[model samples]
Target: MPARPPAATRRTAVGAALLGLVAVGGCDLDDLDPRSDPAPGSGEPSEPPADADADLVETVVTALSTALAATSAVPPRDRAALRPLARLHRRHLAELGADEPVEGGVASMTAAQVRSREERLQRRLADWSVQAESGELARVLASMSAAVAQQLALPAPRPRGAGGGS
Candidate 1:
């Protein structure tokens, strides 16, 4: 029963939504065949390199969880939030497994361990986020995510055996 947005507003909204789609869905899903590496070229690599931001996020999530697990500050009270974040990482890793494999069986890692790690990492990140709005620790964390993205982009080693199995 509310009034509709003005035409300009509607157009702007649609454009924003489309832009979001391209940024989130378009950039990450482009396929890169394992056997065909890009020929050395100019003008900032092509549409999709091997790794995408999403892949990087997945790796960062793991590292973050690991860092979290090893942290000393997180109290028991804030621990519950980590479960959902860990689950998100697990789901993201599963999707990555279908497209690109992760080093070490992250899927096989216990949920409890992941939860513990995430809790610690969250506490640490929260602390760091507070201390320096923009600084070395933040930069380091950001850099780690980028590194993970780059690694994800590399073609996975070809599987062994006749059927590509070990």
Candidate 2:
């Protein structure tokens, strides 16, 4: 028989063969192409049922009002600053014909807490806007969401100085 290749050479050949087998074995010729995957809202209803959209809008309005009420104790300047945001939500609620009572009681909240609540409400409004059945309603919700988001970026009012001094 012909002399066998050096041990190192044999080991190298075996490793190469094993690597090739593993690489080829892992590949599937019939694998689905990700590029062909269906796009969201394609061949399906993009808008949610009318009643569901109405309910979601009502819920978002209520939550925003509740949050506004909760921030009542945050300095007067801050509270005044937040009123416009609450008014905007109310306007949207009126436009939607959602007459739900603003639920929940007033609770003191830090500026950070107010910001957090506004952020959450903004996100919820955005989601509801996406699911709204009527284009007009969706536009309103999206506008409200954008307004709330813009307010969130504004700095909270500074507390009045204890002593009136320079």
lDDT of 2 by residue, 105-147 (tens): 7677766677787788888888986887655556666666666
Clashing pairs in 1: 50-153, 51-153, 68-120, 68-121, 69-117
C-alpha RMSD by candidate, in order:
17.2, 20.4
lDDT of 2: 0.61
User: What lDDT would each prediction earn against the true structure?
Assistant: 0.40, 0.61
The local distance difference test score of model 1 is: 0.40
